[model samples]
Target: MKLLFVADPLASFKIAKDTTFAMMREAQQRGHALAVCTPQGLSWQQGLRVQARVQDIALTGQADDWFSAQPERLAALADFDAVLMRKDPPFDSEYFYATHLLEQAEREGARVFNRPRALRDHPEKLAVMEFPQLIGPTLVTRSSADIRAFHAQHQDIILKPLDGMGGMGIFRVKADGLNLGSIIETLNRDGAQSVMVQKFLPEIAQGDKRVLIIGGQAVPYCLARIPQGNEVRGNLAAGGLGVAQPLSARDQEIANAIGPVLQQRGLLLAGVDVIGGCVTEINVTSPTCFQEITQQTGCNVASLFADALEAAVRGA
Candidate 1:
């Protein structure tokens, strides 16, 4: 199978920690052809969707690990059996446009994971607010008054931008904390966009467990993002340490409940974050943590992903 990871630049990839790289390595070990590109590299040409500067891949954990595919423009996207929309997100307008383009690939009968339509429609926070019992006390609003009211009621609340990822625009508000007004200002842009406010779960001080679900079942390994001192956001990219941890029954239940719907939507891979067993985010765009999980368990989860991908390809 020829797979393309529409993600960040290869030169900038930290192979040791990149989940995309881990999957690419697995694809190669299983004798699948793999390539990569960013959204900008994607274009529609003469009724054919294509990418620029794609190359074949090679995997080596040793010093020689490198990409061997020469820098050639890619074949038509539909030429490949599958495409992984592995781009990280703020789910900005441009990313939406990319998903729109991938929708065309679906029309052309190519398999696109986290199905383009599903990816486009699902906003990380709002998607799971449907399950209030599994989520913390949550509210999404653009009104500064409501935000303040929630903070007042909870005494401490976590404010997250509706469309942000990698922990960007996530702020902690205290009952008497400073800068509440400015935080509200940042969240409200003339009331066009709404921010998500949830009761601050004290278990966040312990960690936010990132559970990876492939084909809608909980994988054995999960990475607990333990927040550093004085930090409220437990994001590994935000200086949180990635420690291996066991999933609580609630975590597994959350995964099981969410998985089938995700699979039916063509989301082959997903990472949902649970802090204090409260579902915080459903990461469908480019859910990561494979490298961290593999390192701690000495398990090649990438192989499991490969197994799933092969099944998808065969079914496709």
Candidate 2:
């Protein structure tokens, strides 16, 4: 099968922990043709089917110089057996536009995983609202009053921008309410933008578990990203220490309950951020930690992902 991965630049990839690279490697081991392109490479000319400036890539077993690419050429997305959208987020206007173009390609009978329409509908931070029973007390608002009200009731709360990634723009307000007003103003842009506020779960000390679900099934292990000293964010990008472990009963329960729904929604792969057994985010776009789980737990996440991709392509 020819698999085209839409993601960040190959030159900048860290093979040690890059999930996309892991997927590519596993697929290559299985003798699948692998190609790559960035979101900028995607194009939709007037009557042409959505296409990309794609490069066929070969994975060399090297540390720094891992992948060597063929010269770029234009190809319709439908030409690939499967198109994996593995672009990391700030899910900004450019990413939004890329999804629309991918959606157009899907209309031309391109097999895109984690379907384009589902990607647009499920913004990582906001997607958790769909499963209130699985998440903690949450509120989305643009008004300072609304945030203050939520803080007053919860006492401890977390505030973050809707489009933030890598734990950026996240603020925790304690019972003392220090800098509460400033945080609200900065996050909401003085009521011009909306922000997500949730009751701070004290179980963050244990770690924020990233439970991966592939093809409507849960991976038995999870990477628990534990926050470093004086840090409230448990994201590895935010300097957290990742410790992979088997899924707890509660984690499995949450995965079992939510996995099938996401699969039905066309999100073949997903990562659910759970702290204290309460879901915080539903990561549909480029959910990661494949290498971390593999290194720590001996679970070959990329292999499982490749298997799912093959099955999906066969079914399609």
Candidate 3:
């Protein structure tokens, strides 16, 4: 199989921890051809099938210099056996436009994992709304008054932008409401944009668990990203300590309820974030922790992902 991974630059990847790299490595080891491109390489001109400037590459099995690549060439997205959308998010306009192009490729018979339309539909921060029973008290609004009211009710609430990633722009307001007004202004851009506010989960002290769902089934282990020092965010990118552990009963319950539904929506892989057994986010774009969990638990996550991807491609 010829696989095209649409993702960030190879130079930017920390191979030891990059989930996309882990997937690529597994596929390559299984004798699949590999190619890659960034979202910026995608283009659709009048009458041409949606295409990308992709580089066909092979993994070198080395630490510093990992891949050897051929020069970039134009290829229709449908030319590959599978197109993996591994691009990370801000989900800005460029990323949004890239999905439309990928969707066009799908019409041209390209098999894209986590279908482009599904990615557009499930904004990581907003996707949890679909499973209210799995989440805690949450609110999304642009009005400061509404946020203040929520804060008043919850006493301790977390405020973050609707499009934030990697724990950026996240704030916590205590019962005293220190800097509540300023946080609301910053997060909502003075009511020009909406924000997501949720009751601060004290279980955050334990860790924020990332439960991976592949092919509508839960991975047996999850990476619990525990906050370090004074940080409130338990994102690995935010310097959290990642501890791989077996999924708790609550984790399994949440995964069982949500995984199949997301898979039906064309999400081949998803990372569901849970704090205190309450769903916090549904990460559809470029979910990580594959290497961490695999190294720690010996679960072979990338291999499992390869199995699912191969099955999906065959079915397609």
Candidate 4:
């Protein structure tokens, strides 16, 4: 089988800790040919959809080193058996363009994980607003007055870029906090990007959980990320450490409620974040954490994820 992975770059991959690399390894072990591309690589040539040059990939011990696949322009999506849209995000215009291109792949009979059409229909964070009862005090706004309105209701709030990934551009602002103006300005200076302001959960001083819902079933476990000193954000990218943990009734309930929703959205694998038993966010685009959990808990997360993904794509 030929598979193309649309991702950030070719050479800078941490195989031991990257979910995409892990999945790639699993696919390779199963004897599949692989191609790698980036968002900038996608282009439409007449009726043929082509991607920038792709190299072979293999896990390597050396940092920023990957065994390169023979570089070549990728053919139309119909020529490949599957495509994994594993690019990281800030959800910029380029990312949206890639989704449109991938949708073309979906039309030509290439199976795309999580379904390209659904991706276009769903922006990970906003999609979950449909289930408000499960989440925290989330306010999506570009107006300072609206943010202040939410701030009046909650003394402490978590501020994050609405279109970011891996916990980037996350900040915690307490009541009458310092420089709310500066913070909002910093987030919007690039343009008028809406930010998501959520009620800060003091419970995060303990941890936040990243739960992976696969094919409508919660993995038997999820990761609880303990924040570092003086940090309110529990995102792994923000220096939080992941520990193996079991699901509480609260956790199970959250997963059970969300799993079917994810399935119906055609998001076969999703990472849902929770703090203090309240669903904080839903991460659909390239959600990761399986590597950390598997290492800590001795679970075959790679195999489990791969099996489920292949099953979803193959209908087997």
| Candidate whose lDDT is highest | 3
lDDT tens digits by residue: candidate 3, 194-237: 99999999999999999999999999999999999999999999
The alpha-carbon deviation from the true structure for residue 5 of candidate 3, after best TM-score superposition, in angstroms, is 0.5
Off by over 4 Å in 1: 49-53, 60-65
> What residue runs in model 3 are displaced by over 4 Å at the alpha carbon?
none
TM-score of each: 0.95, 0.98, 0.99, 0.91
TM-score of 2: 0.98
What count of clashes does model 2 give? 0
Off by over 4 Å in 4: 49-52, 58-68, 188-191
Candidate with the larger TM-score of 1 and 2: 2
Write the residue-wise lDDT of candidate 1 on 1-316 in tens digits: 8888888877777887888888998888778878787888777767565444566666656644466656667566677888889888878889998998888877877688878898977788788876677898998999988988888899988888887777888998777957888888888876877889898899988889999999877888789999999988789889999998777898899998898888888889888899988898888888889988888888677888888888988987
Q: In terms of TM-score, how similar is model 1 to the real structure? A: 0.95
Residue pairs of candidate 1 with colliding backbone atoms: 56-69
Best by TM-score: 3
Using lDDT as the yardstick, the better of models 3 and 4 is 3
Which sequence of candidate numbers ranks them by lDDT, best first? 3, 2, 1, 4
Candidates 2 and 3 compared: the better one by lDDT is: 3
| Every candidate's lDDT | 0.83, 0.94, 0.95, 0.78
